[model samples]
Target: MSEEPPRRRTIRDVAKAAGVSISTASNALNGIGRTNPETREKVRRIAEQIGFRPNALARSLLTKRSHSIGIITNDTYGRLTLPMTAGVSEALVDHGVSAFLCATNNDPRLAQLHLEALLDKQVDGIIFTATRADLTPPIDLTRLAIPVVYAFAIGPPTAPTFIPDDAQGARLAVQHLLDRGYRRILHITGLEDYLAAQLRAETYRDLAGAELDVLFGEWTEEWGHEAVRLVMERGGDLPEAIFCGSDEIARGVIDALRDRGLKVPEDVAVVGFDNWRVIATQTRPPLTTIDMELKELGRRAGLAMLDLTRGLPVEPGITRLPCSLVVRRSCGA
Candidate 1:
């Protein structure tokens, strides 16, 4: 009762339409083997017009490259991994490559299994990603034969890694307040042990100097609310501004300020880190925060893996990308 779909176009069809030998067409399509530049362009144009897509399996067999990559992540919450994966996919798809994502959720056995499965699938390379920028895998990453890269994840010192510039992000938040003429600023952040927290606090201290009043606590709204109370009880001078380590913390701080009959940006300005839209955009006055540029990091990481697979040299070391400040009403600017 239903008509079948017409036949799918193939490389053979593309070759005939392009008026070239099959081998020549293949070379042109792949941009390899000394195909004439003009001919390559012509063939690509024809292929596009004709909607001719290459058979990945056959092409892989001929080129000895799987044309697929693997992403191994431990961020079960999808907060970081999802956006990064989206960026990675964008880069791969443009080059006609496919990617597979394996979520390990911090389970060691699952991580190992996914690693081995990716190897078995003959992925061109692997990218390790996680929620935490400082996450160091328990596995020995140095031994893998294929190209390995870390995106917001840690690997061996010699490996290529991409992470946000945490200290720089901190500076942006604190300086935004100072630029708004709030000289006395307080810093309230996550656990002291977290590398992100440590970097932010260190930068806050550097810029705030004598005006710095730092509070290290859990990365929770409860801690944020309590820190304000602690400051009040200590009889310390209330800060002109508060720089929060997270959007969640900023929300708590804003609420606490409201309870104390203070108006945000009028009585005190607040700046938050991790422009996580869910929390940042919902605050009473909205939040001015730092964006980690995580999606861009993923794109860079994907391209880096592609470079390694093609025998291009990638300088090995941690590449710290800059973070950007997002301004909103909360910062009074």
Candidate 2:
């Protein structure tokens, strides 16, 4: 006689084995509906023993939750994600939620494509990191079925957002310089149109007043070098100190200052932002700067998503995280 095909195990099989009704078995397995604790455990154990794996697609049809979160950004996805992405991913995993990340390469079309893909995948929520001020969001972010949170910067159409308080960050750096008794401060920052760059420069101007000598340029070590050159070219009337928008710029400033036969701190105190660990402490005489806490920012974004999923309310509008000053040998502390 030909061997009979094996019978597929279903909720009926589990229910019979656990001495429960089919409805009770299904409820126990899905954690829906009410069932006695003992019966629920018994049904679950029977299903496990029978090697029964519920179809997730079918389950999703019954329950709208897909238990996934998507993150979309514009720019060098790798460089920008950095510590921020790791923080957000880690937090989501801890809650048994999966995360999807996509980069737009600063292209609006690519950004829109990624956004649509994530939406079609039925992600529970989305986090968008805007590239620039003019960039518009693909969806009516406020009308999406999923919750959306904006990070690092804002795009067109307001939504829940979080961004580094560059003004506060610069304030922290400037306060550090002042606390060390450095007046006549010079600032080397990124392009003036950049929100972060503009904020940092403005904050320094507000606090430093006439003492502030601002230099505009790209966020590169090259700019830092030229800033010092500008100081020297000003007929040897150098500022008492320097504040750089980035650690790279700070590095250039340090090189140029040393080349001019000047001593850091002892000659011109220097401070920068973005407490880039590799670039900061690794230097001969470590540099002082403001820490942006990008990773913490990512983690906060993840937590905000979680709150939204659970129907918890967050403070409406943009939220700013505090920045801390990291003192090193560069600034006379």
Candidate 3:
């Protein structure tokens, strides 16, 4: 007996069952062009009954739209990029798009390699996060005919981007402290080379408009502890409030301050950023901070990148999202 042709239910099979033309069945399945509503419904019902799944590979070969995007991040699994990438992935799912994730580890060679791989995968677009915006990635991505967007950080000049309003977040934190009747406030933040840290520092200085003392270091808890030590070593001139760049740093500040016989909110107030649960809730007294809305940042970036891929006019510049101060026991706000 002749072997039955491999039982692949094609669009023709669906159209035959639904009593519709092949083109009409295609239109209904792909949601392309226009088709009669009743006929479309009938075609879909018939297609479902026959277990007809559209061949995405064949469809992509025809239309050249892979319905996928690549996300290249500085870190792989944890850190700030995790939430942001998750948000972007969530948004992509809503839009019927897939995400291909790649970790660059903030290395130029690796980032370039990953970029090439994503390009080869024919991703509709790309979203890249880098360690330093000014580091000048050497990836020559101009050959790829796809849109690229940056999220939570800026990439090369050839892409549109979105980043949290760090300066605004800092301003919100400092303003809250000042409004709470705290004059001697200390700023504990990351290195000045980082754009986010620099912006926060500048905004604090601008808002304070005075010779304010700032303690700058990396984003680690060690820096936070060191800031407190420096303050204690300087004697009774300790600030009435401390503004930290991240929740990790804030946790360190809390430990150091408590160990040195100072009462939070009673002797000094503290404010942090990122609004992470581990640092905000896990501490002895819950920490107050500015919520940067990381997930929303990723979602917006995904939408913007899709727009770019469609040859639609995207606002070719930085898009800033709103941030807010989350009041907790830390700042006594």
Candidate 4:
């Protein structure tokens, strides 16, 4: 058995209560037609007192714009996109814009469907994001009438793509070890094909020196352990420090070192990329890692899209925000 819904409050009721015509009530509630400030405030106060709720469809029809935006992503794991989405949402909420997320899960067809549905709903804008900064979104956003922004993922050539500066992030890590007076640095990182890995590795070589070795493997804890094994099999003293591509790998590095009766920071200082706090903070001595600031990237992306919708001047093309080091105990000072 379904229960009956409560009677909805309307403008006519609000007008009667405020002693004004229905037309005047609508104008005051909508902030249009230059209504007298005192009268407008009185109408609004009465409207609130009676719990009056304006119709969204009616408001949109009058405003010619929807106050909602869509977020489309294929980040199967929320690790990267969640914080990014939070940032964008925070920025949009202040501007009276609401965001709804549509997860594509790497399915191209589903992504297209989501995009179409958002368009049908008359969303003011859309944001495309993903787990990888370099991977293109599964959907093609060609010639869409509404404003769109890319964050934590790559988009079209001319699209405003916001991502962390991976090269700088890598440089910051390697330089941290160097500044701590460690010259014999070792680099262990994720797959070679990932742009993030490539950029970080390239910068590591530049800052850690070309002669120092870099071990490329999966972005996993097992790979970190294996990397340590390989280093030991070479039959030499371990490097003064190791710079890993991710916090997961860093944890494995720390664990493997412990198994070999080695002390972190005391035996070998270790640093990692991605301040993934779940793993980073849980590490034995905690992890000193680079933060990509995905939220800040998302915030910027949100603001940029709003500016675009308003026909404001927004710089086009890719925008790489800076990543900073989140200090922890693993690196000793």
What is the lDDT of every predicted structure here? 0.88, 0.80, 0.82, 0.90
Give lDDT tens digits, candidate 3, residues 1-333.
898877989999999998888999998877676888888888889898999988989777766788899988776555667778788887778666889888877677998888888878889998876544444444655456778787876655556778888888999999999998888888899887888888888898887655557778988888888888887887777788889998989989998988888888888899999899877998768999999888888889888877877789887777779888899998774
Residue pairs of candidate 3 with colliding backbone atoms? none
Q: Give the number of the best model, judged by lDDT.
A: 4
lDDT of 4 by residue, 196-270 (tens): 999998899888886667899999999999999888889866788999999989999999999999999999999
lDDT of 1 at 229: 88
RMSD of each: 1.8, 4.5, 3.2, 2.5
Candidate with the larger lDDT of 3 and 4: 4
The C-alpha TM-scores of every prediction are: 0.94, 0.82, 0.90, 0.92
Whole-model lDDT, candidate 4? 0.90
The number of the candidate with the highest TM-score is 1
Off by over 4 Å in 1: 1-4, 210-212
TM-score pick, better of 3 and 4 = 4
How many pairs of residues collide in each model? 0, 0, 0, 0
* Collision pairs in model 1: none
lDDT of 2 by residue, 29-113 (tens): 8878978788788888889999777766766676677778888876574655667788788778866578888887766677778
**Model 3: lDDT of residue 11:** 98
lDDT of 2 at 74: 66
Comparing 1 and 2 by TM-score, which wins? 1
List candidate 4 segments past 4 Å from native.
1-6, 16-21, 36-46
